[model samples]
Target: MDKKTILTMVLAGFLGLAQAQNNSTIAEHVKSATAISKVLGDGRKVATVILEYDAPISNRSLSPDSYEVEGKEVVGIYSNRTPETAANGTDGPYVVIEVKAEVDLDARPAPPTEAEMQEKKERDRMQGGPGLRAGWSTGGSDEYPGNAVVLQKKEIRTRTGKVYRADGNPIVTTVETCPVADRFTQEEFVSPYTGQTLPYNIFLPENYDPGKKYPLVLFIHDAGVASGPVKQPLYQGNGATSWAEPEAQARHECIVVAPEYPVITVDDNWNYSHHLDTTIALLKELQSRYSIDSKRIYTTGQSMGCMSSIVLMLKEPELFAGALLVAGKWKPELMGPLDRQNIWIISCEGDSSSNTLQGEAVAIWRQQGSDVSEATWEMTQTREELSEQADKMRAEGNHLLFTHLTGGNHRATWFVAYGIEGIQDWLFEQHR
Candidate 1:
């Protein structure tokens, strides 16, 4: 249950200019870039690197905030190594370092050069004429270079003036592509029952073969509010995209179906009676088309999606092996059927009183069960503690886990739950 730090997969030349330098003593321990996250509004990119070395690391030298990209000072550093104390060596031989920098703010596109403009003009002429390509281009323009946001390797320097260059090349591309084979794919799910076509994102195993059966994770996305439009799960929450991330896909290759529900509904209901039917129909259609392990199907979601997941758990418990419901209320009247399935409910302290009350309902329900262990999350458990609790729950043959996130934002409760180390693995292990 140790929460393995999730690293972003940076492709070759991930640090384009950074890798040009000769490898140094530090480069000997350099591993691939595990992950990168962008805060567009903040004009920064947080990149994580993994290093394995025999010698002890200099705390200040390895600190994430101590590194810089293109001379922009790193705003913060977080290392997932032993004792979080200053320069603690007990936690290492291997360390994961998160380097945060204003890479985007400094990499703003420069005005196009005359030569480039002429080249674009000529290319446009060949394609059909001046302004034609620009008109057709989705976001490209003659005013500036399109695709200018290249993820280059920036210079990495410590606070003490020491510099380090990557000895390794990028193993993945930062440019997001569609239908990336074995990765998240955007496609239409045609429901034969309603003759309705819904847009959805599915992640297939990298080594997918028709001959093999894989688990199916049906993620129902929260619908924001009753008045908003229905969006794809990935749009609903970034965490939903994690199912398709290289890290998650690598850990447990499965077929993840995130369907978009129509926005024309009352009270933002996602898992209501009629919608549940359509959702199931969608699932059936997906199953018929893909190599899905019928017994290993699972579902998880937040808010509206969580409600939907709960409804599905009740109406069609036979269809799912497990369910993780976050930031949603549970109806006691309908609790009768949930006992048959493996369920985990999570909420945050910042969540609405209704969410916390639901957790209490789950706790009360657990007391009536023959096999149940009740623990208050109080939003205070560390990641390690959460993992241990997850282990203990599975060990005790408990069917329900209600955890309260005491301090995080309620809107993001699901994100943190999804980030938990063994949660997804635990769900995947359940089979009817």
Candidate 2:
């Protein structure tokens, strides 16, 4: 059977402050500013802005009213060179301004038109491309800024007690930093067993030291992005980026590996592919190359990727401490005692395909005394409610976690699932 790949929704933005020309003395000194973005549960937003000044500025003279930001609210202002707030004093060259940025990144892309599809098919035929024509991915949209952070100059007192008003438009010229995913570097992997090549994006923790060991997360993409591009796994959904986010890292401090399989790794019937073999090879190579905590290694994926992750765990159950399977399922008979291992199965309540298969598998696990913890959550619940339930389950000491989400569908289930910090926390806490 041909692998029926699942395509995913894509909602992808930046801020600017490059040149400020005004009559005020401070205007001449202000060349531009950099906007730092962060991926929150809602989407991507400008977390802070770094103003580059040619002279020293007093923190006491700077306030939230010192600048007018378009489409954003300035919460507090500081002249510290670093992103963090500092004591009120004279800090030189750079000023960090905190911005209130909470926006949603959940827009879904429209399906292709008939003409567009025909054009794409013709192009594929001309190029002799491989793989099913339906595969899609989110390559780098979430990591890079998609919208702008506009800053407007206002009157402010300099350190010398001199007042200045440039009253000029401050265009945000650069987006120099992104939290967590910023540390990810692009690399390639080639299988020594099958000689097949795969391109992937890898994230290492800050101040990585070989003297200490860090846990690792292996994120597999859904069929949606398997054939799209090299880094689609990172952009397709939060599956790859969630565990590496700053808050999650603060708790787990692990490495992340996201590969674009470029081919179907498994079919709906559990037919396997060579890419799975290469994935295992890549993981083994990474263990030898980095100080990865082997006992804490975990696998998580969506759809086709989810099934492949299960196959990986089955092929070498000893290599995985736990697994988070989202929006995907396999037959209970062919699952091979995996219910006895640490696994969490999550699916949207209304997704007939996923729910039917997952329910059957969970039933089998329960029959065998797998001691699973099952919960149904509303996708509209506030973070506090979700976290509260997650904390409760975390304390249950069960190896299997099955969550059925209401008010959500299959494709979008992952978007909300990855943003659930409570579930991420539980994943990190598991160990062999």
Candidate 3:
């Protein structure tokens, strides 16, 4: 008989056997077997048959892991595998062939008992797993013996060598570590061209000697801020603060030259063009007096001060090794015409003015094929989360770094941006 006729006859016989036994048969298992044989057959005198039975025969169950049919008298069974009596086996009647078949049964795990669920809920509540217990503060109390149960505690010693909490908690509140300002000799220098008396607050390193030449960071203040000769009472704004003095000088290991602009503005408007001339004069005067490293000199500023740095770069790109512009606007037309310089742009996402201007500058710089690294401060997420994303980007060959702060506004963004760990190390790594 033909292969098609043989297959039809075998299917009819299986259907008859299923009806006689009062058992439902699946036609799909037989159809799959037939399809497999047809693909494997090489024009040999072979036939494919579909069979249905309560238990699969030993030869047909070739592989427990793979789905296939083999051997003579292949009987396809769709039922749960269980040890049963087999009269023909050497292992006795209790040894039965294992068979795996699709069966309808409950596959889900049993629901927890009421008492068990209540126990778990209580355990979670004590551990502050979630929900209402999330805000439960432990404040370094010894009552919470387990380290995992303590909310937030860090080891710290006060200036007086007293053991205290570093991170803020209920028991140990955050203590401000404001340092005494280091005394430095003040000097005034006259501008050669304009004859304008310009004063610079020169901070010599703690271990300063006349023989050593030191690296310098020229910090410029924004408009209406007098920061040169007279140390004005510290007003915090534009990403800089008086607190920055001790931290920056200690960490950077450099002398800070903060120059003041007399009559900070020529007219009512804060014109960077006018202040640029004064800055140039002041830098020259400072260079004459102090043994400053020309190649290692860096410039950075906040707000209008940042604008001044950009203006200085435009006039004399070779003056400084690198520039960090924070929350400042740069004119796109002027930027395109300027020579390439090592630039690091920093701005918060909330600062609309800086974001718009800096975004434009980045695009233009990319088009010009200039080397620039941008560090952005986004206020939507925490710092740790943003650092993770920044690390991923670094892996993907992008120079942009991001510092995200939770509950950060435009004003407070710079407090974290400039104060990022190893910021100066990253900044000075490259010089052009």
Q: Which predicted model would earn the best TM-score?
A: 2
Task: Please write out the lDDT profile of model 3 over residues 1-432, one tens digit for every residue.
Answer: 123433343344434543433432232112111111110000111122222223233332222222222222223322212222122222111112222221111112235567746755775688557322211221211110000101112332222344322243221101111112213334566766677666655667667765776677776654434322233211222122322344455666566666555533221122443546767777776778777777777787766567778778777878887766766676765677443666656666666766776777677767877644444435443546554544443444333332333343444444444444344555554454
Expressed as tens digits, the lDDT of each residue in 380-420 for candidate 2 is 77767888888888788888888888856677567667757
| Local lDDT at 278 for model 2 | 86
Judge candidate 3 at residue 310 and give its lDDT: 77
TM-score ranking of the models: 2, 1, 3
lDDT of each: 0.53, 0.69, 0.44
Candidate 2 — worst ten consecutive residues by lDDT sum? 1-10
Off by over 4 Å in 3: 1-185, 224-229, 233-251, 265-270, 337-339, 371-410
Q: 1 or 2: which has the higher lDDT?
A: 2
Model 1: how far residue 28 lies from native, Å: 33
Give lDDT tens digits, candidate 1, residues 170-273.
32312221112214667776666667666666777768899998998887765432222222344334445555555667788788887666542112222243
Per-candidate TM equals 0.59, 0.74, 0.50
